[model samples]
Target: MGGIVLVNVPTSKPLPIMTDTLQPMLRMLWFLLHGILPLAAEATYLIATYYSDDVCSSSYAYQVHAVDVVNCTSLTCSNGEMSSTSRSGDVESTECSTDYVANMTSTLSDSSYIIVLRFEDNNCSTLYYGYGTTELGECVENKYQGGYSISTLNKDGSADLEHFTDSSCSVAYASETANSSAVATHECSSSKYVWYTGSAQEFASNSNGDAGTSFSSDGDVGTSSLGSSHNMNRGGEYDFPPPSRDSSSSDARALTLVSVVFSCIVFVLVAVIIVLYRRLNRQTPVETRSGLWDDDTITATRIPRTKISIKKLLCRGAFGEVYSGVFNRQQVAVKMLLPATRSNLQHVNEFLTEAKMTAMMDHPHIVYYVGVAWDSLSDLCVVLEFMEGGDLRTLLNKYEAERHPVGIDRQKATIALHICHALTYLHSLSSPVIHRDLKSRNVLLNHSMTAKLTDFGISRERLDRTMTAGVGTSLWMAPEVMLGERYGVKADIFSLGVVLSELDVHTLPYAQVKKQCRETEGPRARLWS
Candidate 1:
């Protein structure tokens, strides 16, 4: 499976019944009126407006098209399209759908507005936009003529910039230019026209110079007018209200907002109730995906930090620290991210990936993972079965120091075989996992000396060439991995042989291998000499 993907496709709208020559006919009519009327000497002109989206025509510096998933295959997968969520991005569109609720704030990486189309635990679509962390001042948008400045030469009437004055095309705004042939350029408030375009774009100007349908006086002006109140129902598109039905449309929009907000609150309450019910009933979260839990799966196994009791620190690592701890009255190892590392998003993502990988293992030869616990992101930690026998490296050093026979024995062979079992399970998965950093230090031994593999910090699935970033201890890393080339299951096998060599020599690799050869072959030996 290619995980899950959602594709956004544009919607289609047909032009209201009109012949192809109608546009040219309207142009000729305007020229004839300009030629005949003396009103052109001192006139008011409403710059012709078109219903099309040009990037700069709106105040938004960045646009996010949120792919709306009306019907999901599952929480992880969907197929649909996103309407642009700019405050005015959809005002001119022919259709709108508000089936899903959206929430936004200007607090992301770019310091811009972020609107998310959320489903289950997944944020299906993310949009970052608006004026770079700066809050828009009231009436400030008028400076940009509706916070949307147009400099485009695609002048099929680029803006819905309505200018009326004493002219033949008498409208509410005015421009200095009298002749229809003169370039008419004017800037107006963002509230100009809620028009439609493309093949669906059509207009019949009456005596009043009203090109399209007249908008209601009681319509949302722009981003500033909507404020923060309607975020719950600020969905795909806004329907333009009819002139006379202004009161009714406002009421309808208000009702829609109210109802959608209520639904969202109810959904949140239901989700809370479900979580409480599960916690109250002590329902154990079952493992899924055969040892490769994702974000959702990891969330299922989440426990509050209050349930964990730290005993003592076991070891320190690059980005995290492991502590011997107690959870649900069982001895466990709690691996927590360092306080300094928690603020880095990349580190946090890796920690979560490690949590998911740890939670997915279900084999006896692999370190048993307990639930993860956190009160907040700052206290994030994963619980695993604690090993009383420490790591293999310490055990080997002990035997070598005591002057005991330090070669491959029954116990060492058994340890090697147990590691093989773990590796076999990992490599045989549906999406084969590679233990990229396999070494003696990562192999844990319990009180009974039963070995299980641990430390999945850099392990990865062999789904593609992108999994080539894993480099463990340089001495133990396979040549292909060290060379940064694409490698597979055999890369781990190479590391396994290195481990077996450790069992035979009870020493670290490379340096000691030649030393042993020198002792065995004598000073006169060609290679060792």
Candidate 2:
């Protein structure tokens, strides 16, 4: 060098003075050649267009490149040769012939997108492999081995990715995220994936491959076809069809109606049974002995023995003694056979006949029969209504003692009318009855002063114009009955006349005859003789 000044270079130090500068220049050159140049050469910007149908109709767009993919429509690729006609008439292409599709950069569009690779032709109707994202690189690796035809991508992406082992993508072995790129090698090895949005994703398997059946997510739960139309929301929910009413529902309604009707019928039947039970209980008869003398004689009504209470003696007779009593809370007169008379069949018969006769008589002027009671260990008593006003004989005696008139014709007529009425009721029967003995002592008066005929001890029912000869009081007896002749109902009228006379006279009939009687008189001369 002619004009340059030279300094001594230290060889051992390897030109330490220029090492920093040269090293930097070489490092920058190497970085440019190794990093930037290769990046520029390998980088490819690709726009992928997808179609819902075949032949690239109804297409939407997605993008892909060498470094990463935005949206991948197909698995197959060439060197910038794979192209599809987009909606905007823009022809976008990618080179994936020598590389796996997932190795390329992908960008999904605002609209959903799916990748469907076909084996027969460019149309997606033939054998195919479906995928949701390019992360599944296995789908591209097996592309040639499986004979792919055409590849198409859907504009609407799926919410979930279902992977199937068959070409139809029906039999699902795995479920994955829609944006996942990891390979499903276990249950989904060599499987296809189908992207669904608003439809339910169900898998069906066959020996050939798994097939996909699509149903609206809102549809009834059962096997359904993917071809059914449904609306998909942004959240990937599907609005499915409503379910139909089947025979099972109808049968349930019918059963409910029948049950209600049966319940109503049962309720009505139970109510009716209850009402009948109450009615029968009310009508049930009290248990008591039927007849005092004869078991075959049944009374219309019977009073239990517990219902009678002896109060006081009311009167006495040869056949029985009458006592005031209480029966069923009402004052009553009870006539019981005397001990002395019990052994006499005639007196017992007379007492029983009185009860039987009064039991059937319903006249207002007749004493009412109130059934019978057991007065003592050996005595059976006949019960009758109590006469608070006593008998006509007592009333007449009270008038005589007070120096009042023995009888007013008006009072006598009223008493006579009542007695007549009682006799009429007894005689008007199909067979007339004759009261052999009638007198003031045998007539009773109620609290209201209404006269009632009583003392039916010797009464007889006359079938024809005849009567028993030996039954009558000597004073009240009809002339024919005193002669021991057969009599008729008129005998009772003759006895009634004597009762009226006694009421007027205020004394017993034939008082002189009774006073003059002596033991020496012959029995017939003292009476009918």
- lDDT tens readout by residue for model 2, 1-529: 2532546665765643245444554454445435433322322222333322233322222322221222223432222212111223323333332222332212232222333322232221222322332222122211212211112222222233333323323222334333212111111213332232211232122112434443333322122333224433332333322121245554655565556545654654564455455555765534565354553332444467778888766555434677888987889998887543454566655666677777877889998887865534346678898999998877876776687676547877888899999999888988777777777878999988899988887787886668657676666888888888878888888888778777777666665353355234542122211
- Candidate 2: list runs displaced more than 4 Å: 1-299, 343-350, 375-377, 512-529
At residue 349, candidate 1 shows an lDDT of 79
Q: Candidate 1: worst 10 consecutive residues by lDDT?
A: 195-204
lDDT of 1 by residue, 322-387 (tens): 888899899999998754356556777788888888788899999998888777667788999999
lDDT at position 95, candidate 2: 36
TM-score, each model? Answer: 0.43, 0.41
For each candidate, how many residue pairs have backbone atoms clashing (under 3 Å)?
15, 35
TM-score of 2: 0.41
Worst 10 residues of 2 by lDDT: 180-189
